[model samples]
Target: MKIKIYFRIIGLSVLFVLQSCEDFVDIDSPNFQMVTEDVYNKEKTTIAAIQGIYNQLYVANFSTYGVSVLGAMSADILLARTDTYLPFDQHELFSINTTDAGFNQNIWSSAYNMIYMVNRALEGLENANISDDLRQNLQGQILFTRAFTYFYLTNLYGDVPLLLTSDYDTNAIAPRNSKEEVWLQIESDLDEAAALLNKQTEYKDGERFYVNLSVVEAFRARVYLYRKDWSNAESFSSNVIARADLYGLEANPEDVFRANSKEAIWQITPDGVRNFAPEEATHFTLHVNGTGTTITGNTALSDDFLNSLVPLDKRRLWIGEVSSENEHSYFSKKYWFDNDGEIQQYSTVLRLAEQYLIRAEARAMQNKLAEAISDLDQIRARAGIDLITDSNPGINKQALLDTIMIARKRELFAEWGHRWFDLKRTGKVNTVFSSNPTWQNSDALYPIPGEERLKNPFLTQNDGYGN
Candidate 1:
């Protein structure tokens, strides 16, 4: 991938070009010549346009906090110390309202802004005089970005507006599409991306940041898994797993987040010196001095979650603690760096481990118990937990699925919205949150951001949040 070269140019030029547009989805750059002709005239400039989308992704609050922290807070794994995060943590209690213009709004706006940029790039690519190979690659990249954005949008706010073009007037009046329609579009984009993207080896530098064939396959597996399309989920996941030459499970779980890990299928590089720390580390780390006393810590692992880890599990090493006045406080070590304070991690969007879990769950749903256990064993082995033995005998389907869910909780926690999405998709939100008096069944879906509904009268609020 020529990602390094594109990103280097993007760091310098992305901001200047982005300033030309006023509306959220408009792509009319302030510099008329630069936006209309120059951006599409040259291969480098076109690449930069695509790179600009990546740049937006690097700092987008939605990607950094919305998907990671907010997602975790919505689940049972993490607790919020600040009021800023409390709305998400206590969303089930009606803390999150249509008017709350915090994370919920940021997530919605940031996602649409990126989608707007992507649509502009796609239009530019279509009209550009670029090579067929280069054009196809760029198309794949843009489609993947759009699909990824819609995936989150639909999941976060049900029945989101699906804007396919950069026509601001058309998009402004666009109405929400059904979740099913949105998912179909997501799969279509991923399928096209998989077809057009080159194999991992074709890229100049074996960069995992850019969209490649393996990444497409992996994401397809995830989408299928979410849709409960077991066969497709298993098949797509297996495709990625078979490409061991390109991706594999890292022996150490921490290595999965390191800058040079082979396990990373796709990751967004952090920006600047201070910003070089991955978002998770910046938000999740609890500051403590050499004396082991807590100085400042914003979030921590819930006691219930911490106690759930088995003693010998290697993943337990990814959690650390500091002594407070009377008790020990713990935080996620998944994104932690050294005390010397150097940036050593990237925000991993997709990796090999998730494909395994997806396949395991998909297979279990299909009643392929033995095969499902085999996939789960791979993750268990990597986590240093005891693998489920075939000799255990007479494992029921529900029991095996319960085992897979537990594995997913431990293996994929505090990453993107996997835990939160898992609970929602499995119809377990009500069962899981039954004890919380404030949690209504409707809490499973977040309300559409109030500002969005205001701008487009066609939009409707989710069930619990009145229009």
Candidate 2:
């Protein structure tokens, strides 16, 4: 088990440091046949190895507030409150400061570091000395993590370099893979994770913090919906939706984001590292002077996004505001608490509402218009809005699809990169932002961080960018 122990140690490197880090940066190659590996002797240590990756996600630039902010800014949902965020909000990215700036640290570099941790843990698990159940749990967690990270990577930057192993020597110079190839790997990883996690009927320690079977199905449902595999998307989403004992829509709209809520299929506890409320509140909560001129925080909900919400919608209540003599600034309060010491809210990654949306869109695309409206009604019922079935029972498939997309924007805004990825995937970026001169066809994909290309010459920049 020398290999297991050695790889676990590499995971420590992933958690503690990742400056200019590419995938699996330290070791040239894992000497699989090396001497006695001892890290997996106890189940606790094995769990810890996987736990380290979760912690990495919490503190890592990409996970905490990075994806939400960058995605919101790039899309129409959020407007820049500070000068530093102007580039992202304007659909242009730059690196005037250094590679350590927001874009590189949050998306490119940190995501690769996240993948590295997952790869290390996956390799260690192959010959681990743990019990079968523990091994399965660990494997399920690692595989899901790899897929989750890659989901954002491929969506944010088209055709990323897919590195699945911890062999730095082979991966360092690797060229980018096609977007379709990366997606296939994502589906493959999720398929294996589903098999590994299938037997676990409950969450780890009765908390949704850890990945479980439902989480796997929920994520796969999302991936399938993105890929336009409407059949698989509807099926996987239905799997999660059927588990009523463990999940449901919180009757109260505000209660959905609270810790351990009934609606959460999977959530990351804000109980480590910084030990604060979820980054959703900490980052998106805004401060403004009682005047037209001043605002704080990196971003605030954009005028377009704010105007899009119906005035009486319950979901609109999630927006907090600071009003001035002439203007009012709005911010998202999904997490509800922003003070660093208060930990009431967990950063929600996956929830049942999203599955409903996914199912709705998938069913609509498959011409199951009535079933699609039924699914859409679940979320609307929670949001205290008029149900699609009641409002318009005869809505056409294309109109239902369009309506679900709008619901996704309203319901899932300021969460992950849902809106940003949605615009790109659905070919609506140009249509949505047609009036804004700053929006462009080329801005759909993020630039490959220049630092990454410097290290790996095979890497190329996205459209309308330079070295």
Candidate 3:
């Protein structure tokens, strides 16, 4: 199938400009008959349709800013420098107008748009006259994409409407599903995705840009870890770790974000023109001028969080200092680019380090202290930090878990809101934020977007956010 088939089916004019390849088949209009006949009939067009779902990740609202920025700002790892993002930085998201059209609104609407696209592709593939192999592959890709989107949605908003169909009527009136139900669906999707996807070794070009079997397994490990399914989490994470040839940890901490690094299980490339650089770089990088660079970023590493990193850790190299006339400030260098001025960095959604953390936490929960310590030590060794040893430390299960949490904060800080999600999953949001005068128990979950509530009357706002 040709890319036009997807654009026409979704009525997306913006995507039509992104495609440079000549159309394989021409259509007189974007009608159902034309799309069904021209798109669903061919394997190429069907693959292109699946690619459309991946393309959505490059959108500003999806991974670039919505999840990464909002997630970081709401946590202790990153601090907002201006009033524009202060609401999130100060934990005032509950105070934002439910009806306001802003980043929050964009995050909600854009995620659902991606979900709808996946569902549409799935619907088309089901009835399309295609081979079993092609059909299964497409199904796996679509399911993984849907599950990924829902993981973010459910984490941010607690409960979300699960739209599995492309039909507008069905989606419009769909009620919010419980977080448990949504998670169950996510697991089911990942299970099916794992069954259908080709292994990482089978992927051409060693690409981490698209979903593969290892990516599915890694995500399954993460989902299980979040659900406290310790044994399954450890097993799934161990499965990914066993495939070291394909998904080994990068030797250098800075190399993890480089394009197609082995550490990355899944990453999203920047879109053609508008999204030329990783979105996090814009907020985290210092401003450069004639005199010297100044740390005038929209966001920066929080002082308390920055102080927590030990000098011996290789991960500390990811933070840099810039000096102006009389003052100095610090910023994150995780997304820094090379001197060549090309966009060689990608926003990594999942990586090998996280799998190690997942297994460590799972092992700790299962009382496999020694194994958990070994996994933690592997990540620590890469970071140039002191390893946890049975002889050097008298570590109990709770103490080891605490150590693992701190390791996670230092290892994964400023990367896609891992700190924020970690705190929420471990039931430490209140304990961590109790010092803030404005902090409330209900602030754990963001309010459901107002426009969505208005569109679907069945939708209810999270507690403490009045409907």
TM-score of 1: 0.91
Lowest summed lDDT window (length 10), candidate 1:
1-10
Off by over 4 Å in 1: 1-13, 20-22, 25-34, 92-100, 198-204, 270-275, 289-295, 338-342, 390-393
Q: What digit string (tens of lDDT, one per residue) describes model 1 on residues 260-359?
A: 5788888887334333577788788887666655457667889999889989999987898877665677888888755667767778899888999999
For all candidates in order, the CA lDDT equals 0.77, 0.77, 0.77
TM-score top scorer: 1
> Which TM-score value belongs to model 2?
0.90
Which pairs of residues collide in candidate 3? 1-44, 1-45, 2-45
Ranking by TM-score: 1, 2, 3
lDDT of 1: 0.77
Clashes within 3 Å, all models in order:
1, 2, 3
Residue range 410-467, candidate 2, lDDT tens digits: 9999888899889888999989878778777877877787666766799877787755
Question: Which residue ranges in model 2 land beyond 4 Å of their true spot?
Answer: 1-36, 95-102, 270-275, 289-294, 324-327, 338-340
- Please provide TM-scores, in order, for all candidate models, with all chains considered together: 0.91, 0.90, 0.90
